[model samples]
Target: MTQQPTNESRLERGKRALAEIDGEAGHNVVAALADIAPDFATYLFEFPFGDIYCRPGLDLRSREISTIAALTAMGNASPQLKVHIEAGLNVGLTREEITEIIMQMAVYAGFPAALNGLFAAKEVFARRG
Candidate 1:
């Protein structure tokens, strides 16, 4: 049988996830998440960062921006996409650049999706301010 992960392995995964997200994780993230479901943080690191995000080619910022575009194209995902848009910003995407990307989506993803994306961006901007 395959070996199960130890608690240490889980924490390592968690740390890796945070690193992938911010490129440099702060103590606050681990301290906060560790207070809640420690496993959740680990899974974020193990699956999202270590497994999926660790894949070759795309940098984290590109991944964040691309995810924003895809979620906007999908539509009916304003709330979730809004979160991702904020994540894009956290990853260093400029407002103008994100706006241009959203606008460009209109051609293929349709006006409704683009509109929702714009609204989401507005929410992110407002929240940031």
Candidate 2:
């Protein structure tokens, strides 16, 4: 019998990514969207986690930092921000380090956005405790 290609499928990659990034968090997010938009959740898994996040250049901790920063800058993605905050901690970012990242954003993203991010971080920290 001929051997199959060693390359993995998107779903397999996505499952691996999910385990690394935020297995339960991503699962809950996708599960919540299953009824309303199943395809949307699949894309969330396939694209962000499988394709983008798994790329080796940035390491998981750095990725979460950038993700937290971007979501914090958006000033409207608190829910997602909260998830990334938890993700940051999972990847070994200390509580103070995460706080500093958000605080430093105040210079460019403005006080309101920084404050919102801080609140999101606070909530995440509380939950983890």
Candidate 3:
């Protein structure tokens, strides 16, 4: 987990990381891209999960927090936001922690974005129940 094995390809490393972080939801996102942009799925796996997420500087929980914050700020990435919110939970983020993180975004991302993020969180939470 510390380093990508020398023998593994980026795709392999990414797939492993994606499974660890996003689980089924991550696989679904990649699968959905199969018909339209298969290469994009490879890119998504390689760059974010493989290259960035595997870095040891931040733990998975911290990474998910950052991701949740960024997606919430974007305000238009509800689908991505929901996926990451679930990912956040997968990586040990509590519902309270997730709610607080989105609420804090209101200062910078505005109330609308925060509200949207909260609603997305609500949906994910409801589904998990």
Runs off by more than 4 Å, candidate 1: 1-11, 18-45
Candidate 1, residues 56-104, lDDT tens digits: the string is 6787678877888898899888865766666677677888988988888
lDDT tens per residue, model 2, 77-97: 998998888888878899999
lDDT (CA) for every model shown?
A: 0.70, 0.83, 0.94
Score candidate 2 by TM-score against the native: 0.92
Better of 1 and 2 by lDDT: 2
Q: 8-126 in candidate 3: lDDT tens per residue?
A: 88889999999989999999999999999999999999999988998888999999999999999999999999999999999899999999999999999999999999999999999
Answer with 1 or 2, whichever has the higher TM-score. Answer: 2
lDDT of residue 104 for candidate 1:
86
Q: Could you tell me which 10 consecutive residues in candidate 3 have the lowest summed lDDT?
A: 1-10
**RMSD of each candidate relative to the true structure:** 6.7, 4.4, 1.0
Better of 2 and 3 by TM-score: 3
Candidate 3 residue pairs that clash: none
TM values, all candidates? 0.68, 0.92, 0.96
